[model samples]
Target: MTRRLLASYLSLVLLALLALELPLGYVYARGELNRFTGAVDRDAVMLAELAEEIIDAHSTDMLPGLAADYAHRSGGRVVIVDRKGAVLADSGASAARGRNLSQEPDIASALRDRSATGTRRDAGTGAEEYYATMPAWSGTSVHGALRLSHPLGPVQRRVHEVWLALAIGGACVLAAAALTALALTRWITRPVHALERAAAQLADGRLAPAPVIDDGPPELRRLAATFTRTATRLHHLLQTQRSFASEASHQLKTPLTALRLRLENFEPYLDPRAHDSLDEAIGEVERLDRMIHGLLALARLENSATTPEPVDLDAVVADRAATWAPFAAEQQVHIAVAGQPAGPAVAVPGAVEQIIDNLLANALRAAPPGTSITLARRRTEHAAELHVIDQGHGMSATERERAFDRFWRAPGTHSDGSGLGLPIVRRLARAGGGDVTLQEAPGGGIDAVVRLQPAAPAEDRFHAGRPRAVARFAAHPARAPRTAGATAGARVPGGSDVRT
Candidate 1:
């Protein structure tokens, strides 16, 4: 953009220089030609008067000397022609003592009692010359024509010198214009580029203070000021929102705990029918509590601006699998861990664990008895992925699209889930500079996939010797190995393949 701005500015300057200089150069050359020609014409007329005086006095012998002296002083040739179409004297050489003068255009016009001036090339020297002729009259009877001829080479040389000077001046102007354009472009684009970077950081959830740029054009400076204010306001608003969510969750938790305790206290004094109703009430409270926690988690993840660091994916996966194993057993479902984690992956601290926990909770709610859930980690060239595969009634395309929406539940699914799990998982994943996707699992279920940034190679890290634990958990007895063919047709919405 800066280059384009500079180029455009310089182009206009060059055009302006050409427009002004070109016409000025032509006029200067024309003026020089006219001035030289005018001087020659005046000299020719004066010589004609001298020749007339000589002819009237019948002293033709002095005419040659007079013409020769004038020719030497003026740097021109002079010819004295009589009325009878013949040269009487020539300043150049004796060979022109009687050369015909009436046939020449300038001399013909001069014989008609009119002065004439013109320019023509000399055949002998191949150089251009300017001629001026005037008739010498003795009482209206033409005595002879005095013609003056000057070579055009000197005038052309002067014009060339003027044009060269103009060219040099124009070049200097263009150089200054180029420098001015570059400086102006830098001045304008510096703040604009800074604003662009700030905007990008904001979009990436970095709500820090924007850089202050107090220089450049007034409009740009004002724009930068406005941007700084806007970023500050936005950051404040987001921080306030996160604070509200956290405070509200904390505030609600006490009352909810008291309500649950009160309901439990009444359980011992109630009949079976009332006890069943009281249990339903307690379940609703628990659901609300879970929802509050989910909101707090989402807020925390959204507000966090922590940079991602390298984490051992194998350790996280194994730990999460072990934690979820007992819960899977309670649902009469088996948990299977498969696939080796490839090196350390990059993620926000504890982000992978939170993602795994949410996915496992959701899968447990959907999985039926005797179904096996698979926890797998896969690595690609640029990314590492954790996938939770379960055999359950999978969601449709529309449900998959809104799966990450808060409180959104798929149709025909049980109400045990708070629906904030997937949303929180997605928020955490994105906060870690990663993403979460839901796909149809093999054998009619859902695959919750989390993509994280791949860690830099060991040699590229500052502390290359730090050891990473590669946790390998034992597969459960009820776990069944998956076949590749069974997962062939599974695909994430928007055409992303989790298997890859």
Candidate 2:
């Protein structure tokens, strides 16, 4: 954009400069030519007056000395002819001294009492000349005519000088205009480039503030200001969305918990066939509840800008492996971290931990009991990376592509697990300026790479991940604690807490 604007400005400057110089230069050249022609006419008039005086002094015969002097002073060819068209005095062209002048239009016109002046090419030299002829009269009776003509060489030379000057002046003006245009273009374009970079950051969810640019044209300044306002508004709206989702999720948990508890209490009273039917009903409710929980977590992660702090990546992997060990044992799978916790783990809080837990649970359900699930974390240049790899029947490319979509699961996979696990991991990673991706694991397993922002150098404090327990706490009416002692064997019918 900057380059294009600069080019346009330069083009306009060149055009404007040409418009100002072209006509003025031509006019200057024409004025010089006019002045040269005026000089020729004035000399002709002066010579005619001189001829009258010479005739009045009683000299009709040729006056060689006076004629020579007139020719020298006029810088022209002088010819004096009588009333009978007999040449009287010839200055330079003396061969036709007695030649009749009646044949010449200018001379004939002068004989009729009108002055004649014009310019034409001289046949002798092939050069343009200005000529003026006036009547030589004695007491109102025209005796002859005096003609004076001069070549226009001096006038042409003056016009040529003007032309040269105009050429040089135009060149200088255009050069100066180009330089000025470049300077102005930079002034206008620099700020716009800055704004473009800021807009990109905003698009990428960086939420960076727009830069303050107090320079450039008035209109550009206004545009910069408008961009800043738009970025601010978008940031605010995103925050509001996150807040709304969290609030709604918190509010819905209470009823879901109470309803599950009531359903579980009634399960023992039903017959075996009825019990089996009741289990299916409970499973569907559990799926719905898991989906809502996933949504709430996704919203929270998307709205957060919190950076990772110092925590042991290996420890995180190991701890998650240990916590999911029971589920792995149930599936007859070996869940392990590839390496010991070597350094301070990146502090990813509860959001990231839950994402990992969900991914592990899904892998355990899909893979055979003997499958091996490995979790590992390593430091990277920009962040700490976590991997959850499972040696199970891996999904196809299409399945992997849609794996992170909310409520999306493979057709053959267990219907009991909600499809929100991978998406929740992705949201958390993105919120921390990181990302999550699924790939074919080494030797035909599923590999999930999760990244989180690097911790600050000095910080060791890690914000605890959102607690699974607190997340389950109900604010809805149905989930309030019952007064009587609860049965030890009674379990929440749907362990999942879903918020729509």
Candidate 3:
């Protein structure tokens, strides 16, 4: 940016200099040529007067000496011609003094009672030379013509020097402008840079400041102050939200649990026919408790502004599958771990576990006795996927689509689910730069998939210590043949919240 700004400034300066200097140089060259021409014509006329007496008397014996003296003083070639255009004297070639040499245009014009002064290029040397011719008159009868010529090399040299001086001045001006533009660019962009850093830090939940000094532009300084205040307010709002969730989770859970217990205790006092009503009331309270818990989890997940980090997805899957295995077995269902190594993936520090637990809890609820819940780990083009497949009746496209909506549940779902689990899972997954999706599992079940950004692979040495990690869970050879298959979906209630 600084370079671009400086270049723009220098370009304008160069154009201005070119605009002024080019015409001044052309005009100076023309003026110099005119001055040289006029000087030569005057000198030629003065010599022509001196030669008038000598030529009229036909006493041209000392004419060559006079021409030579004037030529030496004026740095030019001189020639004296008689009335008939015959050369009488020559400063350049004394041997050609008697030559008939008036065929030249300037000499002819001079002999015709006219003066000539102009410049012409030398045919042999390609150098420019100026010529001035004057006619000498003895009472209106032309006595002779005096012609003087000089090379324009000296005037051209002066013009070149002037051009060089102008170019140097332009370059110096451009350099100074470049330096000034660079300083100004830095001064103007400093506040912008600070605000950019602060925005990034805020995105990462750091709440850094956008500090600007008074030396910067007024608009930028005000912007920096406004940005700092806005970021502080935003950080405070989010902090308050997370704090409320954390506080509410602890504060509300016990009351809800106690309320459910109190409702159960009223079972004895209620009539036999009212026992169903008492049970229904207790169930609703429990549902409310779970619902509130899930809502708080979602709140924390959303407001924490947690950044994704590298997680050994394979290890996380294996640990979660193992943790849920006993529960599956208690229901006479096997937990089947399958698929290739998913390697490390980018996810929130504890997001992978919460996502797995929520999906597994729902899967266990859906799976039938004697069936299996399959924990499958696989890699897609740019992400790792953990699909919790259960052998229960799968959801329709509509149910799957609406599953992630907060507090949404399938129409015929019979469980006492709070309908907040799928939303929580999705929120956590997205916060980890991933997603949770529900699709039809092979052979009839819901495939609850959690996809995450693939991260740098773990070291081989680390994997070497866990050679039995061929599936989502560490292999148990003694129980390798255990029965396992497809479980629950996106909108099912979770068993517990794992939110650390």
Candidate 4:
């Protein structure tokens, strides 16, 4: 932007210089030529008067001296001729004293009682000369012609110098204008740059990213102030949400746990018929607990600003697949990890695992006995993808579109399911500059895909190949596998493109 602005400014300066200077130089040169010719003509007239007086006296003794003195003062060649064009005295060349100059064009015109003044090329020397011829007349009787010639070399040099000076002046002006334009462009674009940085930080879940830039134009200053205010409000809202989630964690969990434990303690005192009802109640409590956990996780994801870091995609896929393999075997189902190995992907901390865990758990719920669930990792030019493909009857297009809405469950979903899974998955992916989408598998199932922002070829990792991570399944019998990600084609309304 600065370069473009500077170029535009300099271009206008050059055009103005050309428009003004070309005509100015031309007029000055023409005026200088006119003045030179006028001065030469005046000198010619004066010498003609001197020649008239000298010729009228019929004594040519002082004619040569007078012409010589005039020529020495003016740096010109002077000559005196009679009415017949006979050279009476020559100031420059004594050899031309007796020469007849009647045939010369300027001398002929002067002998005819006329004045001639203009430029001509010298026959003897290869140079341009300016000649002024004046006739010597006394009351209608012409005695001779007084002619003066000056070399055009010095005047031409002066004109050339004028042009060179104009060129130098224009260049200096352009340079000054460039410097001024650069400074102005920086001033104009400063707020824009600040806004761009703030937007990036906000996208990364940061609060107020930077201080407002208030030194630009009025419009930009206003925009910066508005943006700062908006960011501040957004930050406050996120902080408030974080506080609520944190407080609700203690308040909501303890009561639900105590209530469930008390309900279970009554199981031993009840009859077998009432025991079934009690079991249902306990199951409801567990489902509520899972829902609360999902809600709190989502709150945390939304409220915290987490920078993306590199994680080995292949290692993550392998570890999670191995962990779920035993669980799939228990249900007489298989977990298959396939597809080409990809480079590391960038995501927020624990985002990949949480997304995969939710998707895999959902896939397991829909998988039939003896069927296989595939975790396929693929790589595009700029991003990696992990597709949790399950062999189940997926939702329709309408349901898929609405799947990303908070707590939006499809028709006929199990009572144990929490609908916040897909929303959490999407937030996690987007935090790392990636996205999630539901695609229909080739075999009538849902291919739940989370696109990954590819990390650098050689990156300093956040948690590269760390085993038994926090989200890893240990003592799995006490905890039911979560359905955090929408494995069965819960998609955003818009379609996606293959970004390379």
Candidate 5:
């Protein structure tokens, strides 16, 4: 930006300089040449008067001799013509004396009248010359005319000098302009450089509280102050939101825990028919509990501190698979593992486990019994990939797109789920310098891949270990369902909120 501004400034300056210099130069040259020509003409007239005075006494053979002497002294050619316009004497060539005078109108006119003067060329060489014609009279009677001529070379020399000076001056002006432009560009770019660095630090989330200095131009300083205030406000707002979510989670968990315990105590007293009806109620409560747990997990993941240490992807998948083995076996589902030639790990611990758990749970619930679910880890030059594949019902393109959207359920499916599961998985994976995707599996199931930074020594376990259990179930029958028929308000049980 600074360079462009400077270039525009310099161009305008140069154009102004040229606009003033061109006409001024032309006028100066013209004035000088006119002054020089006037001087030459005056000198020629003075020499003619001197010749007339010197020859007046002798009056017979003296006119021709006087003209020759004038030419030799002035270093200019001289010619004498008779009153009839016939050439009487030439200073350099006496053989052309007494030539026709009618052809030279300027000379004939000068001899016929009193003093008459003009400039013209003789009928010989094309070289330019200045001429002055004067009558040579004896006792006020016109005898002949004297025409003096001189070359115009000196006038040409002065004009050439003027042109050279203007050219040199223009070059100096351009050089000065270039230097000024460079200095101005530096001045403007310095402050912008500082601002750019500050913005980069903010983007990296490493900026803490610091007062910004109001330095640089007025507008620039204002911009810097605005950025500082904006950052501060955003930081405060995020802190407030995190605190609110944590507080809300804590408040909601209390009654949920109490209700779960009461349900457990009531379950034993219920008959078979009541127990069967209560199971559905229990499932709904569990679903609501899972949603709350997901909200809390999302909050925790969002507030997690950055750790640069490399994490083992293979170990994370293997560990999660082992932990979920019993659950998968109860559902009669098989789990397997595969990967790239290079076994590498991602760069986050608990994040990888969370992502794996969400995918595995979704896959197990959707896949048919005895079907195999594959968990594979692979490493390329740039990234590491971990895949969780299951032979379950595959989703359409539209479903795949919104699969990770929070609280968005597929149409016509009755299984209880908190939509926050996939969204949390995706967020955690992305925060760990990785991404997650859902693709078509080999046997018409969903293939969920977790891609991350590939590097470092493979470990049998993650460094940062287990997370706290985030799920709970109802402990009593009446406390379990709380459906519209069961509760006083006729409200459904096991939703986001249970109204009294």
Candidate 6:
């Protein structure tokens, strides 16, 4: 940008210089030429007066000496021509005596009793010469003509010197303009660069002691001040929201626990008919407790802001699958793992585990007995994907769209789910620079997918010692071969299966 500005400035300066100096130079050259020619014309007229006296005396003896003296003094050529257009005397060897001068324009004009001045090329030397001619008269009767000739080289040399000076002056002016343009550009761009950096930091959640800029133009300074104010307000608002969520969860959990304990103690003393009602009340309290916990998790995930780091996704999956193995076996369902040797992926410290755990819980709650749930990992050039596939009833398009909304559950599904699981999973995944999505699984159920940033090649080698397991189930007995395929029942809410 600076270079472009400098070039534009120099170009304008050069154009202005050309517009002003070109005409002035032409006028100067013309004036100098006319001044030199006028002086030579006056000298020729005076010499004509002397030549006329000698011609009237009918003697040519003194004419040659006078002409030679004038030529030697003025560094020019002189010639005397008679009225009949024949050369009478010559001052230089180049001007021959008795030569017919009738065809020369200046001499012809002089013979007709008129003075003439002109510039023309010399035939012998091929050099430009200026000529001045006047008639020699004896009482109005023309006797002869006197002519003076001078070379034009000196006049042209003076004009060239003037133009050279103008060119040098123009170059100096353009150089100064370039320097000024560079300084101005730096002054304008410095504050812009500062603002860019400040914006980046603000986007990354660094809001305390907002960026300060006291340099540059007044408009930029005002903009910076406004940005600082906005950041402060945003920080204050976010802190208030987080505090409310944290306080609400803590305050509600205490009372809910006390209520559950009281109901459990009363169960022993109550009659059998009243015991059923008491158990229902206790179950409601437990569901409320789970909802509060989900809210707390959502709030924490939303508040976290940290840079992503490399994590062994395969190890995370294996660990989480192992943790859920006992529950799966109790329900008579098998959990299997299948994937390639995928490298580490970038995610928040523990974000990947939380995501996998939520997906497994959801799948387990939705899967029927004797059906298998598969956890698969796939790697691509730019990202890695983790999928949990279960064989159960899948959702329609509308349900998938609202699946990430807080406290939203599918119609006629289980009431045990707080509906915050998917939302929390989404929040955690996004905070770790990744995303979670739900789609229809092959054959019958839903596929929960999580995409994460791929780690660099250098980071991939750090997880080399970890074991890679494929198509394995933890603590499960081998099943007997079936004579024919058996299909599981359609998924229903609040049935024998757990809620995700």
* Estimated TM-score for each candidate: 0.64, 0.49, 0.74, 0.75, 0.56, 0.64
Write candidate 1's Cα lDDT for 171-273 as tens digits: 9999999998999999989999988999989987785578789887889889989989999999889878967976786688899989989998998899978
Better of 4 and 5 by lDDT: 4
Predicted structure 2: lDDT = 0.67
For model 4, name the residue pairs that clash: 358-484, 358-485
For candidate 3, give the lDDT of residue 313.
78
**lDDT values for all models:** 0.75, 0.67, 0.75, 0.78, 0.66, 0.75
- lDDT per residue for candidate 4 within 93-179, as digits (tens), equals 877887999999889999889899888887678689999999998989899999899988888899999999999999899889888
Weakest 10 consecutive residues of candidate 3 by summed lDDT: 472-481
Model 4 worst lDDT run, 10 consecutive residues: 491-500
- Give lDDT tens digits, candidate 3, residues 351-440: 776677777777766778888999899998898999999998878998888878877777876566667777877877887788889999
**What lDDT is obtained when candidate 1 is compared to the true structure?**
0.75
Q: lDDT by residue for model 2 over 1-500, one digit each (tens)?
A: 76777678777867876787678777887887777767767876776777777767768664445566877876788878767667777777767777887888999988887889898888778998888888888678887788888888887887787778877887787778778877887898888888989987886668765789999888989999998998899888987896788677867777876777888888888887898677666666655566676666666555555554465455556566776676456547788777434354443454555556656755654556577888876776676777888887787888888887767768765445456666666665665467888899978868887777666557655336523322321211111011123222232222222111
Structure candidate 6, residue pairs in collision: none
Q: Which number leads on TM-score?
A: 4
CA RMSD (A), model 1:
8.5
lDDT of residue 386 for candidate 6: 90
- Candidate 4 stretches greater than 4 Å from native: 1-34, 52-63, 79-90, 96-114, 120-129, 137-144, 151-235, 274-276, 458-464, 467-500
What's the count of clashing pairs in each model shown?
Answer: 0, 13, 8, 2, 9, 0
What is the TM-score (0 to 1) of candidate 1? 0.64
Q: Please report the TM-score between candidate 4 and the true structure.
A: 0.75
lDDT of 6 by residue, 1-500 (tens): 55665677678878887888888888888999889988898888889998999999988678888888989898778889899878888777635888898888888889899989888887778889998898999777998899888888887889899888877887787778778767876676677767777777777767646767787788988988998888888888888987887688778978998999999999879998998688668767766776776766666656656677788888877877786676676667798989894668887766676666567667766778899899998998877899899998988878887888877888987445667778877776787678988899889799988898888868763445433332111111111111122222212211111133
Ranking by TM-score: 4, 3, 6, 1, 5, 2
